[model samples]
Target: MQKTNAQLRAQARGALAGQWGTNVLIIFLSVLLGGIISGIFGGMTNFETGSTQASILEFLVDNLLLFAFTYATYFVALYVVRGGRAEAGQIFVIFNKKYYVPMMIINFLNSIAGYIVGIIVFLPLAAVIGGGVYLSLVISNGQNFGAIADNAFSGVAIALLILLLMLVFLVAVSIVTGVFQFAAWTKMDFPNVKVGNSLRYGWSLLKGRVGRYIMLQLSFIGWYLLGILAFGVGVLWAIAYANVSVAAFYDEARKEIGDPV
Candidate 1:
């Protein structure tokens, strides 16, 4: 039977009960590492004179660091989900090399997909904004407002169409992302699985359950808001809890799919 959101959360809380300190420490280290990386890049950008080569190198280094950190975090969650002892060193499992390239490839493809969706969603809006600016310039140059009134109405119609397109684009992207949400976890848990196979497996597991997954995430919005209300300190705990819950969900999903856990 599929687990309910409350049951999944309870399982997550149980898994985290005695490991809270370790998980909190992991979160702190992750944050510190990210801050240090940002500081290094920021210092380099600020102190070194900008050049095309320097900018290219900076961008490459930034992306590499981001990918490493992201994979490390994923490894940590995978460890927790697999019932391994959560330690700070678990995050370094990405350095195992066997998983590094595959993870990077998966992330790169996901990034490309996101960019395509973003362009499709925003291109019309961009055109509308550009046209609006041009119209404003014409008006400022003393073009007749009466003559442009029809054009303004047409622009309004185009803007409405863009809004509808953006809404549809967002929905489509959400569904796609939800379907593939567990691809990295699949790769981590089942080392033999390739990127494409892992994505397909994740989609198969999530079949007919994307709405439930979305609702599970939405259930935490209140805690997230409360974290923000607490001047961001609560956010650390919120993130830890949310990650554990997601890990718990992954565990349940694997079981439901009879994936030989």
Candidate 2:
């Protein structure tokens, strides 16, 4: 029998919630790998000279590689170490050995998918934000405040509306992207799933199971809630649990029907 949505979600959440030690281990390491990659990106810090520069060139250099390294590195790391079979040191070794070529290829494809969808859906918002900041600058500096301020309320209102829409759009996209991409990781590493098949298969799986996907994604919220409760030390624990849960999603799901192949 085909699984119902609730069934699927309950299954996914069960892994995330019920498998305490295993879930905690995956999450902790994934977060650690994420931080390692993020720190590498952060090392390219940028300094902006006030007023004279149109924008900081440093920002481009600093974050140009961030998109790839951030999402794809931990993705591959987790994929390679999917089941709880691997120990902590083993996962670290997996991260070291597997990251370069496969991650580049995987992340490049992901970036292409994201850019195509993101630009179409978000170009208007980016244009508006760029225009708003320019307007703000012009109104405050280049032009008289009184003249623009007469219509400033209207401009501010429009900007706020645009910003809010963009924020919601981003969140929705992030959740969906997270689902498909994480699924892609599983499909790529699993017996039957070639990298090419991963995206198409993942999209199909995620579409019919959006609610379950959302529920699993929201489990991260509990991690955050705990982080808040513990003055941030809990975040470390939360990360490990979340990573394990992510790994368990595929492992546990496979148990239901063996390998997809």
Candidate 3:
């Protein structure tokens, strides 16, 4: 039988019972490294006044640094799940030559896919709404609606149609990508597995359990809000708890699906 979110969370708590110090250290180092990366390249946010090349460079650097730290955290979570001793050094595991490029490629593709999906879903809706508002305003001013429709409304209608097409595309992409959401952990847990194969495995494992995964994440919202109430200091503990719980879920999920971890 599949474990409940409560059961998974309880298992995480048990795993973390004597490991607070190590987990905190891991969080600290991960934050420190992320801050340093952002501090170094964050200046590129002013690319509005800079060249196109500068903007592109900034974008690449930002995503690369973000992926590095994110993949590192996943590595730490996997280590904890596998019952390895947690150490601050685990946050740097992404720097190891063997897995760095593959992990980065996986993360980059995931991000690109999400952005494309977002654009496809929302861009057309935005254009239609914008044009409708403009037409409404013109009509309110007692302008010639027929002339306006001929001159401007046609363009707006075409744009809306394009947007509708994009929205359908986005829906299709989301369904496919949602199925492979757990591929990253699969890659970490089974290092020898190819990326495509890992993603296929993840899709199969999570095939009918997307709602449970989402609810598990939602269960932490209260703790996250409580962390915010505590002047952000509590967020560190929240992050630790959340990451460990997710790791615990992944372990249970693998077993439930008859996949040996």
Q: Provide the TM-score for each candidate, comma-separated.
A: 0.78, 0.58, 0.77
lDDT of each: 0.72, 0.53, 0.72
**lDDT (0-100) at residue 56 of candidate 2?**
41
**Candidate 2 per-residue lDDT over residues 56-86, each given as its tens digit:** 4433322343333344434533543342333
Runs of candidate 2 exceeding 4 Å displacement: 1-86, 93-100, 112-121, 126-146, 149-163, 191-193, 246-261
lDDT of 1: 0.72
**Model 3, span 1-261: residue lDDT tens:** 778999888877777778867886778777887778766676646555468966676668756766667677667766776676788777878877776877777777777777777776677667765677587667668477655545654676677777677757755564555444467777776788888887788777766876777677778889889988999877877878888888787777788786533
| Residue 222 shift from truth in candidate 2, angstroms | 3.6
Better of 1 and 3 by TM-score: 1
Using TM-score as the measure, the top candidate is: 1
lDDT of 1 by residue, 9-107 (tens): 887777777887787677777788877877787676644657776666555664566566656765676576567678888666666778777777776
Clashing pairs in 3: 124-163
Worst 10 residues of 3 by lDDT: 172-181
